[model samples]
Target: MTLRSEFGREGNVWLMPGGSLLSAALAAALVVVGWDVVQLASEEALARAAKEIGPTGRLVLIADTQGRLPDPRAALAGRPRPFVVAVGAGGAFSTLADVVERRVAAAVLDADRPFADLVAALDSLLRSTPVAHDANRLVARLRQREDEARRFFGLTPREQHVLGALIAGRSAAEIAVANQVSMPTVRSHIRAVLTKLGVSSQLAAVALAHRSCREPTLLERMREVHQL
Candidate 1:
């Protein structure tokens, strides 16, 4: 399921990878138990989204061990990471020995287990104490800021993408290559982005965009990854 699907459900946020039967089943189970499930396209997207959630927000990171999971330490670094749960065939859980040793993951189950057993494990993990704010509220606030920034600055989607590339420290040539556009075109987009954001230079634009989004920092990351 995409992020836009069934938003604002009254429960924890279940971040899952897209296109997996396990993910689909787990998402359904979590939804039945009042979790707002968000299926992202990749591990990077999942990690980035997870960072936006607050301490109080119950976040369950569900990953299949097809080898796309990020280093739990790096992905969960510098923030209060969610409870990670990995399930897959074979010795999938063994690969995450370090993660489990560090107590970063709540549980790692075998995919061969019955769906009911997996759900039961999730239920047990869900009993952990919750903190302060809701993940939905955080997500909504982030969306509001992004909408406000776009509205106030009159930034088009393409302009937002250009701005994101600039924020990532990508040069005009790099942006052109990434976006498959001409150097002149990339420069033109940069100029438009800077003008719309009311910034004098690329550096200023990046700083302004960061300030405009403020907390979460996920917005900036998302812009760079998903092009907003």
Candidate 2:
């Protein structure tokens, strides 16, 4: 299966090589769950890696980092499941180890993760995500998703803009200036977003908006990877 297909389910998402997502999934599945592993990396790389790990799933396309990651609040909106969602700064998860604290059902960040740093962070995170039998992390994550979905649905474009700004940790005045709108307009947008998102406070608004965006494109990832 492709990265999207393999990891579409709920699970702890980590910060690592985009290709590693596929590798980890397959390794966890076939090796641990008695099934074949799928890969989403380049054909040559997959072929070479297959020799090391063995093949199980077919590749539909080379990895394509499409869409920006959902705002942190939005990450809570994704369907309930445990999976890692890594994103680089330009659009990748720098260090989602904490987010995936075993209890983290999924990570929702950028798509421009650095190979070396990502691997190191994920290794460390694997140690953190609660693995205890009594942990209810997945349940909490599911609740978060429902909450985010209810908040963002039918939000107007301006409301979305306002929420996006809040997700950036911007102040209402800053949002107004950045959006080139009036202060009242920004506040109105904020109120509207709050009402729609079912949140009573602005801080909550910012947190939710952070998880709603998706990953950036491959081109965008490359630019960010190079600090371009």
Candidate 3:
């Protein structure tokens, strides 16, 4: 028999025997577990948001860091709300525009001069860009796809509810209000969903919820039932 086929993730390779039922079952189980992890990651993102918004009172840190970060959580840290994107390498890292939708707590400009002056200037241009609203139109369109989630996704009811709220563009605070859970708990659930989906970034998770946006956010289609 040929050796098990190989699949790799995060630098580790998994070899599973193709013809064995046991191997297939294990593989499927692993996939589900992996998705579960993605969901956890999403909730963690919300926690990161809360921390950023919270006080130690808050400070906008400056340095050559936090861009192209592999983990979204690490990407955001200590750099206060209104980001000051200064000149950097070749590209302008417009981190400041991140939460423009919400009023920025504050902005701090870099006083030190840099070689990449042009790049820093680009950040100024980006900061001026208007904030966009969190539109629920996509959630409305994604309702039909819920069944596929139920049938193929095997997500727990709690997972579905948390995901549904996210698709509707509700913040973790909003979800906490609706679900009666503390904001931190809601954030945890969000992280779980991201981990399960194997995605980073809230927008990506929302896009997945749109799932070929021909459907609706699960709750919209579920009707008469409410979920956190």
Best by lDDT: 1
Give the candidate number with the greatest TM-score: 1
The true-versus-predicted C-alpha distance at residue 184 of model 3, in Å, is 1.7
Residue 62, candidate 3: Cα error in Å is 58
Deviation of model 3 at 213, angstroms: 8.2
Candidate 1 clashes between residue pairs 3 or more apart in a chain or in different chains? 56-132
lDDT of 1 at 59: 46
Quote the lDDT for 45 in model 2: 45
Candidate 3: 10-residue stretch with minimal lDDT: 32-41
Clashes of 3: 27
Better of 1 and 2 by TM-score: 1
- Candidate 2 Cα deviation (angstroms), residue 2: 19
As a TM-score, model 1 comes out at 0.45
Please give, for residues 1-228, the per-residue lDDT of candidate 2 as tens digits. 322324344322222233644345333532232223344334344334433331211112112334222222233233333333333243222223234443332433232344444444444443344333332453455345545544455678677666655655579889878768899888888888788777799987655544532323323323343462
Where does candidate 3 stray beyond 4 Å?
Answer: 1-152, 212-228
lDDT of 1: 0.58
Q: Write the per-residue lDDT of candidate 3 for residues 106-147, one digit (tens) a residue.
A: 332322223244224333433344344332332232233333
